[model samples]
Target: MKLYDHSVTVSSKRLNLFLKEIGVTDIERVEVNVREGGNLAQSYQDKSVNGKVPLLELDDGTYLSETVAISRYFDEITPNDLNLFGASTLERAKVEMWNRIVEIDGIQNAFQAFRNLSGIYADRENCVEAWGEEAKHRVELFLPKLDKQLGQSKYVATDNYTIADISAYIFVFVAVNALKVDVFETSQNIKRWFDDVSSRPALQN
Candidate 1:
């Protein structure tokens, strides 16, 4: 398998972290310079029309996109003690639930907030400042609920460090550092949860 990687993107970070945790090192990696519009090129888009990086090409030339879906593929293939998805039926459902929360509420808002506010992607798409500001505001709204959830549960989705926590950990950096929505200061549970999960060895890479 081969992975087309935009090394600095959040999606790449998530998949890299997951692959590290699962200890899958055999896949070939081809770096795509997104800032230079490598991913936007027609040559690259032919493989995956979405034009997203961390695109995986399977052995038979099957193309796969989306960070979490690629991570799930690796998780299923890799048999290790580190089952990041979960261990059972209810657990998988819980993971999917919280992962979606992190993806949509946390990560997607951060993407909109950063891209629109910063106008980083203005060359490719329309950057609306009003939407960016609203997205930035929406970033903190997800935190209180996450904090409440963490207050009751040991982890974000479930007890184990599942994919939801991985998504949330990535979101925290965008929320606290990049977007400057530091409501984690007031929400003790999520702050504690972020600090705890952020300390994992795989994240260090």
Candidate 2:
């Protein structure tokens, strides 16, 4: 299998981190330079209709797009390994719930704010300052809820670290690096959870 990757993007990073956490190292990696329009090129577009990075090409030449879908594929292939999704029905539901929350409230908002505010994405998409400001505000409003959730559990979904934690970590990464927000100061629970997640050897890479 081969992974078409762009290291700088949050979605790609989340996928990469998930792969690492699951101890997947045998797959070949092909880097895509989004800044150079590599992802939008005709060849890549043919492989991924969305023209996005982090496309996983299976040995049979099947292509998988979307970070969550890719992660789910990995989980399905290695069901008894790390159990990143969940081991039980209730655990799976909770994991999916938290993952959706992090995606909708955290990652999506933070990414929108970054895309609209940063000059780096100007060539890729039109930037709107008003939209950026609104997205940033939405992220800020959602942080406390995230903090409260983290306060209740060691990880996002359950006692074990899972895909939800990966999603939240990437969102926090974008919040700090792209939005230029100091989230650590506003939420001690998030800060504690983030510190623990960051110390993982898989994330250090």
Candidate 3:
């Protein structure tokens, strides 16, 4: 399997974390930098084209896009019984719920914040200051929710860990690193939980 990715991107983090968690090691990693104008990078986004980083090209010539889809594909390839998704139906639903929230509140919010605030995508056509400001406001709103949740539980959803943690973890990293969010001040419990998860061998690398 060949995994296409780029450094510091949330999609890249998702693929890498899932691959490491699943013990997938036979991967041929390909890096694509879509920072500005990379042909192969644009191809991946336009599915009809041959480009997209974080795309998984299977040995059978199948091209897989989307980070979560790619991660679930890997899990199905290895073992359908893994607990990363969930052990029970209810647990799975809860995991999915948190995953959705993380994708929306964390990933979406962080992306807007980074692109607008960091000048990373400042020169892009659709980039606007208003969207970035709104995103940062939303990010501030999300921290309290996470802090409250973490204050009550060890993990995001159920009693055990799941892909919810993985999704939320990577996005939080982006929020702190790229968006310059001061994670510790706004949410101590969330900060503690993030610190614990960030130290995991799979993430620290």
Candidate 4:
């Protein structure tokens, strides 16, 4: 299996962190520099219609895209190993729910703020500053609610760490770095949760 990777993208980071957590190291990595328009190349785009990183090439020439789907595939293949999605049916649903929430509310808005305000991807797509401002404001509003949730639970979905943590951690990272939102400084619960999650060796790798 080949993992088409982009070092800086959030999906790449998520997939890499997940693989380490699941102890799957057999898959080889192939770099796709999106910033250089490598994903736009006809050869690569032919296989990956979406032209996205963190794509996986299965043994029989099946191309898998999307971070969540690719990670789930790997998790399913190694049923005996630790499941990052969850261990039980209900827990799996909780993990999926929280991950989707983080993706839609936190991660999406942060990316919107960055793309519009920073004009980083203005050439590739429309960068509406007004909408970007609203997006940033929306994430800022959502942070307090997230912090409240973190105050109650040690992890996002279940008692143990799961995929929701990965997704939310990415959101916090994007909030601070790209969106320039004061997440850790303002939200103590989130700060504590971030510190706790940061201590994991999986994140460092």
Candidate 5:
């Protein structure tokens, strides 16, 4: 398998982190420099219709896009390996639920704010300052909710680590590292959770 990736973007980071956490290290990586318009090229667009990074190409010539789908595909192909999705039916539902919340309410808002405010994306798309401000505010609102969830559980979906935790961790990492927001400082529970997740050996890779 070949993973067409860009190291800097949030979605690419999430997929890379997921792969590491699941102990899948054999896949080859093809770097796509999105900032340089590598993803916008005809060659890349042919493989990924949406012109996005973190696309997974199977050995059988099947291409997969979308971070969530690629992560799930890894889980599906390696069912007997580490289970990042869930171990039980109910657990899978919970993981999916929390993953959706983190993606929609947390990561999406953060991305919107970054895309609109960052000069790096100025030529990539139309950015509205008002929309960026609104999106930043929404991210602030979502942090408290995530903190509350973390206070009740060690992990996002359950006691065990799952894809939901990976999703949330990447969002927080992007908020702090990319957006320059001190998200872990917003809540003690989140800070603790972040520290715990960060200590995982998989992330060191």
Candidate 6:
């Protein structure tokens, strides 16, 4: 299997973290800088149609896009029933639920904040500068909700480190590190949970 990704992009971190979790030693990676326009780097330029990073290429040439999809694929690649995904249907559903919340509430807000404020992708599709302010508001709005959720749980779903944790943590980690959200100040439990996840050996790789 081969993974096509950007070296520094946050999305790539998700795939890399999962690969580390599963101890996938046989996979090869092609890291590149996909340009904003048509000028894409050599590694994924040919395979990428949307010009996105973290594209996974199966041995048969099937291309997989989206960070969450790719991370889940890698997490479940092994045949063992014991994995980050829940062991039962209800457990899996809960993980999925938290994953959805994280995607919408955490990741979306952070991306909106960056795209609107930093003007990073302003040259691309919708580039309204006003969205940045809205994104900041969205993120701030979700902090208290996150505090509520963390008030009763250590991990996001299944009461353990499941895909939900990975889904949420990857985005929140990026926000704290890149966006400087000061998550520690907003919620102490969130800070503690994040620190625990950050200390995992899979992330260090």
Q: Better model by TM-score, 5 or 6?
A: 5
Kindly report the root-mean-square deviation of model 4 from the true structure over all alpha carbons: 1.4
Q: Is candidate 5 or candidate 6 better by lDDT?
A: 5
Better of 3 and 5 by TM-score: 5
**Local accuracy of candidate 1 as per-residue lDDT tens digits, 7-66:** 788778888988888888788899998877888888889998588788999999899989
Off by over 4 Å in 3: 39-52, 80-82, 122-124
Per-residue lDDT of model 5, residues 1-205, tens digit only: 8999988777888888888877787888999999888888888899996788889898999999999999998877764555688888998899999999999999999889888877566767889988988988898889999999999999988888988998999888878877787786778898999999999987885
In model 2, the Cα lDDT at residue 35 comes to: 77
Measured by lDDT, the strongest candidate is: 2
Candidate 4 weakest ten by summed lDDT: 78-87
Model 5 C-alpha RMSD to native: 1.4
For residue 174, what is the lDDT in candidate 1? 79
TM-scores for every predicted model:
0.96, 0.95, 0.89, 0.94, 0.94, 0.87
Against the reference, the lDDT scores of all candidates come to: 0.87, 0.90, 0.78, 0.86, 0.87, 0.74
Clashes of 4: 0
Residue pairs in collision within model 3: 4-54, 43-51, 44-51, 44-52
Determine the backbone clash count of candidate 5.
0
- How would you encode candidate 4's per-residue C-alpha lDDT over 120-165 as one tens digit per residue? 7665788899989999999999899889888888888777799899
Model 5 off-target regions past 4 Å?
A: 79-81
Higher-TM-score candidate of 4 and 6: 4
Q: What TM-score does candidate 2 reach?
A: 0.95
Candidate 4 is scored at a TM of 0.94
Q: Which window of 10 residues has the lowest lDDT sum in candidate 3?
A: 39-48
Give one digit per residue, the lDDT tens place, for model 3 in 88-201.
899989989988998899888888877876666544446778888899889878988888888988888777878888988877788787777898887898888888887877
